[model samples]
Target: MPGSEAIRELVAACVGKVGGPLVALRKIVSAHGHIDDEHVGIVADVFNLSLADVRGIVSFYSDFRTTPRGRRHIRICQAEACQAVGSRRLTREVAEALGVELGATSEDLGVSLEAVYCLGLCASGPCATVDERVVVRVTREELLR
Candidate 1:
């Protein structure tokens, strides 16, 4: 975790900028992996917002995480197109194989499983992402490897 001074400096740099609070939060996440309570306080103070306001922003955005993700993150598409192509079955199988439920990280923090609404590969439905790399027509066998 960065020292409070460091966090304040980071947040201060975003002052007078557009969407300062959101930008500051993103910067903090980029530097520290996730935003914690201390970060939320610093951001709120620097941006002249309430703690609830900053917390609300963090909670509202799926991209923002209050905790660090695992080393390998897997996002299985659950959109209409992907579901039509057996993504539901694939999701269940992958979750079982990984030993982690959706929206959860493994005990060893080596892997995380999450549900994504879409990956824009509708034509190739049943898509998933392994550490940010999109895998089309994904299968349980392919994901385990």
Candidate 2:
């Protein structure tokens, strides 16, 4: 876990420069595997930041995680526009069929399910996600098969 001291130092340096401090932290989280007890301590200690400041950054971003996340993060739009096109029905069946809850990943690492407010593809509606990619006009069969 500590093999990359040089990388750690590089991270420490770059972290303070990018936009606000919070944005820097988010960059690190995206590059690294997961943020947990170790990251919380190391990031704070290396950057000479406070624990409250670090945790505060995490709380602000929906993308940030205190625990671990699946290798892939998936999102399904539940916007009114999407619902009008049957995204609600699609989301329910996809979650059940995949055996994963909203905001949770399947144990097998296939996908993670999340409800998104909108994807700006209202014309397509019925939006879904695979990893970071947004899939529009998705069907239950499309979500599962």
Candidate 3:
């Protein structure tokens, strides 16, 4: 976590004259990987919002992770379309292989596994996005690779 002073400076730069809390959050996340309490407080102060309000925003959005992610991030589709194609089993295999549950990061921070509602690849059910690259018809062996 960065010091309060550093967070204030970063917040000042990200928060424009026009309101863009979502965009500012993205910028902060991109720069720091995650938004800690200090970051949230800084943002709330800059935006003139309460701490709880800022926390609510963070919790409402799936993209805003409160904790740090691993070097590699993995998001598997878990919606009806993906589930129909055996995404459940694939998710299990991935969790086992990585030794971490969904929404958790590996001990060594090698990977962060998360379940997304959809990747907009219904045709390619059981799809996954690894580091922002979409992979269709993902299999356990392929993911392990």
Candidate 4:
């Protein structure tokens, strides 16, 4: 865990950087609960990024955290390109097998499931990323397999 003081300092920075309701929710949950969401609203308000801009940023980048992430983030590509192969089935299987929602991680701290438009590995057709690292081909079995 990040040191409390360090976390507090970061939180202060975040507050200064982002004073929106979404950011406030992030702070509240960070100080209280163990999870939060990818706060697009907060990011927009903080940077004065437009809603469209924020949505684009959030949608284009899978690395941004809207909520508190689990130990690991499992990002699957649901873009037309990836799905053209078999990413759709793979996504459903991962979510179902993990017993969690698309944006949720398992209770075991093993993985969190998410959908991405493209992983920039279009050649791979069916690609996914793990924690902003390890872009690789994925199948339903391979995901939970």
Give a tens-digit lDDT track for model 1, residues 30-72: 8887899999999988888999999999999877878778889
Each model's lDDT comes to 0.90, 0.72, 0.86, 0.63
Question: Distance (Å) between predicted and true CA of 15, model 4?
Answer: 12
What TM-score fits each model? 0.91, 0.79, 0.92, 0.58
Cα lDDT of model 4 by residue, 78-116, tens digit:
888888888888888778878888978677767778787
Deviating ranges (above 4 Å) for candidate 3: 1-6, 16-19
Off by over 4 Å in 1: none
Report residue 92 deviation for candidate 2 (angstroms): 1.1
Report how far off residue 46 is in candidate 3 (Å).
Answer: 0.7
- Residue-by-residue lDDT tens digits, candidate 3, 60-133: 99999998898888988999999999999999989998898999999899999999998888988889988988
Report the number of the highest-lDDT candidate: 1
lDDT of 2 by residue, 1-145 (tens): 3335643664576654655456546655666645665566666776788888777777877677664566666688988999998888888888888889887867776677888888889999888787777888787776765
Error of 3 at 136 (Å): 0.7
Please name the candidate that would achieve the greatest TM-score relative to the true structure: 3
RMSD of 4: 6.5
- Which of the two candidates, 2 or 4, achieves a greater lDDT against the reference? 2
- For model 3 the local lDDT of residue 4 reads 66
Badly placed stretches (over 4 Å) of model 2 are 1-7
